[model samples]
Target: MAQQERGKRSRRSILEAAARVFDERGYDAASTNEILARTGLTRGSLYHHFPSKQAIALALVEAHGEALRPPERPVRLQSVIDLTLEFARRLQSDPLLRASVRLTIEQSSFDCPPRTTYDQSFEAILALLQEADRHQEVLPGVDVQEAASTIVGSFTGLQTMSQAYSGRADLLERIGIFWKLLLPGIATPGLIGHLRTTLPDD
Candidate 1:
């Protein structure tokens, strides 16, 4: 049991160290040595957890999905809004998520075919929008799937721009503006007035 726990810790350390390197240098320029230097772990330890730098990058990209999982809310539309706001907020502090976003945009660096990170994000939002639809929270005539795609695409642009402009210092505020403009189109008129665009008080 102790060995298993240690292995988990070691893997986490490798991943986090790699995330820092990837976030700073991007996938093509980041090196295993840099990740090792960051973690102070030997090559063998890293290989035990990840076979190659691409493997580490892939792992980070996959972990991005975990960050997007929002807690359930009585108002599903609000859940979607909160999820976006929270993700924007996390980008300011979470190296893992920032690295994942970088890796996703630099998909050309990957050896595999183009990834489905966008599709994954779209699916998550689509599920919430579907729930909102069933609850009559979505505006009539709004296609939930299209709305989901738009949300994902818009967020991708928003975060990229936020990162470039202010290192995402203003991301939460940008997301608030985003929802203010977008919600009225997709949310039921009654629900639109109630949706919180800003992050809820911590």
Candidate 2:
């Protein structure tokens, strides 16, 4: 148990370090040596866990998503908007997530990213949309599967862009654009009105 715990800890450290390095230097310029230096680990330690720098970069992407998973599903459209805004806020605040987003976009790694953990992020959001359908929260005309796929797909694009442009001052505006464009079409008329009313006046 102790060994397993230490291994997990070490892996997390490496991932966080890689995120920092990637954000600071970008992927092509970041070296495994620099990543290891950030983690305060030897080459052997890094190699013992991640076979290569790409693997570490991939792990960083997963870690980035993992750090941002929401605790529970929302009951209403307003909550959904709030939830997304909160997610965008979290992404803006976390450097590791910012780096991972950049890594994912630069690699163009969607449909699949470098790590399996990223799939969990997909599933998490997909599950929310699915649950919304179960409750008939999604607009009646929208196809649930299509809605699920579109929302998930657009979010990937948005997250990729958000991460790629992490330091840009208008990050919130970018996120707002995604929602404004998407929600009008996805939500039922009543739900759309709800969102219009509930989204923080901005």
Candidate 3:
């Protein structure tokens, strides 16, 4: 049991160290050596856990969803809004998420399927939107799937622009603006007025 726990810790260390390198240098320029240096782990140890840098990148990309999963709320639409705001908030402090976002956009640097990250994001948002639809939060005739896709795509662009312009310092504010404009189109008029577009005060 102790050995297994240690292994888990070691793996987490490797992933986090790799995340720092990937976030800073991007996938193509990031090297295993830099990750090892960051973690102070030997080559053999890293290879034992992740055979290649691409494997580490894949693992980070897959784990990105964990950060975005919002707790359930009485108002499902609010939960969806909270999820986006939470993700933006996390990007400011979480290196793993930053690395995953960088890896996701720098798709050409790695062999991981280009659509996998986007598809996962779309599915998660779709589930939330479907729930919102059931709650009558969504406007009549609005296509939840299409709305989910738009949300994912728009967020992708929003974060990319935020990262470029502000290094994500203003991501939360940008997401607030996003929901303000988006809610009117997809959410019921009654629900739109109730949903909070901005992040709650920290």
Candidate 4:
């Protein structure tokens, strides 16, 4: 147990350091030496856990997503709003995610397929869309594929906006406004009223 705990701590430290470096430099520009220096770990130690900068980046993507899994499922419209905002918060707060998202866009501009790092993220988002459908929360006339695409695009836009103002109050402030602006248009009149009354701050 002690050995496992130590290993976990070591990996977390390495990932955190790597994330910081990746955020400061971009995915392609980041150097393993910077990660090692930031992590205070030896070269061999970093290599033992992550074979290369790309490997560390892939791990960062997985770790960033796994770290945000909430305990309870979102069952209501308000819950979905909270879930989205919470996701936005994590994306802005986690350097690894910020870097990976940027990488996803950059790679796409070349007409390249999404890397595994982004594939995982896309799958998670698809699950969120499926959930909204399962709950009948999506407004009528909202096509699943189209809605998914739009939401994913919106999410990407939000991430870029947040990265531009990292650590600023406006990021979350704008995200909240985004959900509020979207909700009323999609939700049924009664549901919209409920959401407005229940979440005035939203």
Candidate 3 local lDDT, 38-152, one digit each (tens)? 8888899999999998899999998987976866889999989998889888889999998988888885658776657788888889999999899888899999999999999
**How well is each residue in 82-145 modelled by candidate 1, as lDDT tens digits?**
9998888888999999998888877556653365578778988999999989999988899998
Misplaced by over 4 Å in model 3 are: none
**Number of the top lDDT candidate:** 3
**lDDT on C-alpha atoms for all candidate structures:** 0.88, 0.67, 0.89, 0.64
lDDT of 3: 0.89
Indicate the TM-score of model 4.
0.78
TM-score of model 3 vs. true structure: 0.95
Give the C-alpha miss distance for residue 163 in model 1, angstroms: 0.4
* CA displacement after TM-score superposition, residue 191 of candidate 2 (Å): 3.2
lDDT of 2 by residue, 49-137 (tens): 99998787766666666554554535644445565566667666677776776676565333335344345555556666667767777
Off by over 4 Å in 2: 1-9, 64-68, 71-83, 108-122, 156-168, 196-202
lDDT of 1: 0.88
What is the overall TM-score of model 1 with all chains considered together?
0.96
Query: Which candidate, 3 or 4, would have the higher lDDT against the true structure?
Result: 3
Which of 3 and 4 is the better model by TM-score? 3
Clashes of 1: 0
Model 2, residue 115: distance off in Å is 7.2
